[model samples]
Target: MTLADTAAELRHLHDAPELLQVVNVWDVVSARAIAALPETRAIATASHSIAATFGYPDGEQIPVDLMLDMVGRIASAVDVPVSADLEAGYGDPGETVRRAIGLGIAGANLEDELKPLGEAVAAVEAAMAAADAEGVPLALNARTDAFLRGRDRPRATNIADAVERGRAYLEAGATCVFVPGNFGEDVIAELVAGIGDRRVSLIGLPDIPAPARLRELGVARLSYGPYTQRVMLGALQDLASDLYGGGVLPRDIRQLN
Candidate 1:
């Protein structure tokens, strides 16, 4: 598919009757591995995972160009649509997503970092405007950090704030509102109701409701942030330990990529 077609496909997937589960990839190899799967419809890049692969810590610590270079390579290496986590847009939300479109990124997640609502909404607008200029649908997942960073506040407050921000972002032309962190069925229902069914996205954080439950709650999408890479690294560590003890390799290794 052309980049625009893939972007439209991504948007359609989010609104599909089934829940859209995207495995986060950090590089061309990982992206290809997931994209090669018969059941995989899309790939979302994790900023933290990509940053770690480049020896940088999470946050916007990695140089924006370096980060975009990796994401662009991954997008180019895959046939499925690629969605990237462009953390806080590296200080320029508009230009960042604009460059992403040029690199063939079909979708992106831009966090608000719990900024003032007006500022967050403006960021979403800027990204949408960039997408408009590029003429790609660019499934913009406007992420709100309210629940992730608002633990000190009341739980109700967090939900309300997230819902409000989610609505504002949607109005600003975000395809979906990503609300990461652990949430139960009731809270999920509230978010879905307040933000609009299939408009609230979630993360695969530990102890959150399973995918089946999330689907029941009307979630649009679910994605792991850095957990996918972390889990693979843990397996690698285990393999190294076995090799150091003269153990043989696993018998089921396949040519995934």
Candidate 2:
């Protein structure tokens, strides 16, 4: 599909009756493996996983150019739409997104990082504006750090904060508001209600409600952040341990790429 078409499809997927489940990929091999699946409608890149792959830490520690290079490679390798995790926008949300579009990225996650509401809204505006100037829909998943940063605040307060920030982002042209944290089903319901049906995105944290339950709760999107890479690494460790103990290597491994 053309970049424009892919972007529109990604935005449309947010309102789909079925929830959008994204298996985050960090590199070309992983991207290809997931893209080859019949059920993969789109792909999302985990910023943390990408950073770790390049020997950088998360939280935008990786240079924007380097991150874009990796995401570009993934985009070239996959046929489906690609949404990237641009954590906190690397302090330059608009320019970052513009360059990403140039690389054929269809969507992206721009984090608010609990910034002041006005500033956060401005970042969303900048990103969406850049996408507009480029004539791409760019499903901007504006994220709020309320719950992630407000672990100690009262539950009600955090929920209220998320709702406030989420509404503001939507008004600022965000395609969806990502409120990532481990919360009770009631909190999730409240978020969906406050944010709007099928307009709230979430991280698939361990032990959280299953995708079926999240879909039932009206979540538009769910993607594991760095957990995909973590699980893959854990498997590698297990294989190495077994090999060291004289266990035979399996010969039935299928070529994923």
Candidate 3:
């Protein structure tokens, strides 16, 4: 399907029965391979993986030009809707929306803790306005970083403030609100309850809960962040080490090739 068509389809998938299982793809090849899977319906990119692929850290190390190039390449290579993990939207809200839509990306993630809560919400609102101007429904997943740092930290100490910021993001035209880093089942349940019926999408960290359990908790989406890519790289390193030691390859090695 065309990118525009794919975006529309993804919007529809939000209402489907099963929770959206989003796999993070770092480049064109991985994006194509994952989208080729029968069960895969959409593609998401991990900022960390993307940075690592380019030999950089996750923080705004990569240039916007390079980042957008990677995004466009992935979008062109896959048939499913593509959502990018745009860290801090790369800047102000207007630029974020314009750049994302210009590249034909269906959605993006904007984080709150990267900036003051009020500025983050304002940025999201500006992005939403830009998306509207483009005539494409951009699914802005507003991320709250408070939970990632732990409740003992100053950020998580104020749950009410986080919830209020989340609500503000939703009001600014975000299709989903993502709170990463918190893992307690009860904590997650409370977040889901607080956000209640806002058409807001909640994404759970991979290792926290089983997919089935997360689904039961009313999570609309789930992602592994850089975990899968890290596993793949780690396995590759081990395989290389074993080969250097003159170890025989596993019987399934041929299948991998």
Candidate 4:
């Protein structure tokens, strides 16, 4: 599909009847593998996983140019629409998002680690302007880290604060509000209600409710984040450990094919 078509498809996926299931990828190989899946509608990148793959720490430590190159490669390798995890927009939300859009990225996840609400809203607006300049709508998932960082605070306060941020982001032209680390059904339902019509994106948790249940609670999308990539890396580590332990190879090695 053309970049404009893919961008439109990605934007539509959020409002589709079924919850968008995103298996985030970090590299060309992972992106291609997931893009081949019949169940995968769109490809999303995980910033932490991408940074780790490039031997850099997470939290936007990876150089912006390198990250954009990786994203461009993944987008070029896949037929599916690609959305990038542009962590904190690498300190320049507008230009960063403009570059991603130029590389054919259909969407992006930008986190706000409790920045002043005005600053967060401006960042979203900047990204929107960039996408507008490209004449394509970017599905901007404005993430708020309030819940993740305020676990010690009162739950209601965190939820309320998140709602406040979500509303501001949505009003600032965000395509959705992503409140990662809030997987509890009750809390999710409340957050969804508090945010009203805008979509809510959730992260996969160990105790996360089933997909059907999450849909019932009104979640628009589910993301595995860096967890999916970590699982594959963990298995690779185990294989390497056994390979160096002795001359004997593991008997149950599974082929990608």
lDDT of 2 by residue, 180-228 (tens): 9987689999999999999999998765699999999999999999999
lDDT score of residue 130 within candidate 1? 94
Worst 10 residues of 3 by lDDT: 197-206
User: Clashing residue pairs, candidate 1?
Assistant: none
Instruction: Rate residue 255 of model 1 by lDDT.
Output: 71
TM match of model 3 to true structure? 0.90
Candidate 3: pairs in clash: 176-201
Candidate 2 wrong stretches, greater than 4 Å: none
lDDT of 3 by residue, 1-257 (tens): 55556566766665555678888889887787788889998888888898899998887788877887898888877778888888887766578668877887998877776467778888888888888788777877788776654466664464555577777888887876777774567666767777643333555454467777767777667766787698889999999999999987887653211
- Mark the regions of model 1 whose C-alpha exceeds 4 Å error after superposition: none
For every model shown, the clashing-pair count is 0, 0, 1, 0
The alpha-carbon lDDT assigned to residue 155 of candidate 4 equals 90
| Descending-TM-score candidate ranking | 2, 1, 4, 3
Q: What TM-score would each prediction reach against the true structure?
A: 0.98, 0.98, 0.90, 0.94
Question: Under the 3 Å rule for N, CA and C atoms, how many clashes does model 2 have?
Answer: 0
Please list the C-alpha lDDT of all candidates, in the order they appear.
0.93, 0.94, 0.75, 0.88
In candidate 3, stretches whose alpha carbon ends up further than 4 angstroms from where it belongs are 1-4, 149-151, 154-158, 197-207, 249-257
Task: Highest TM-score: give the candidate number.
Answer: 2
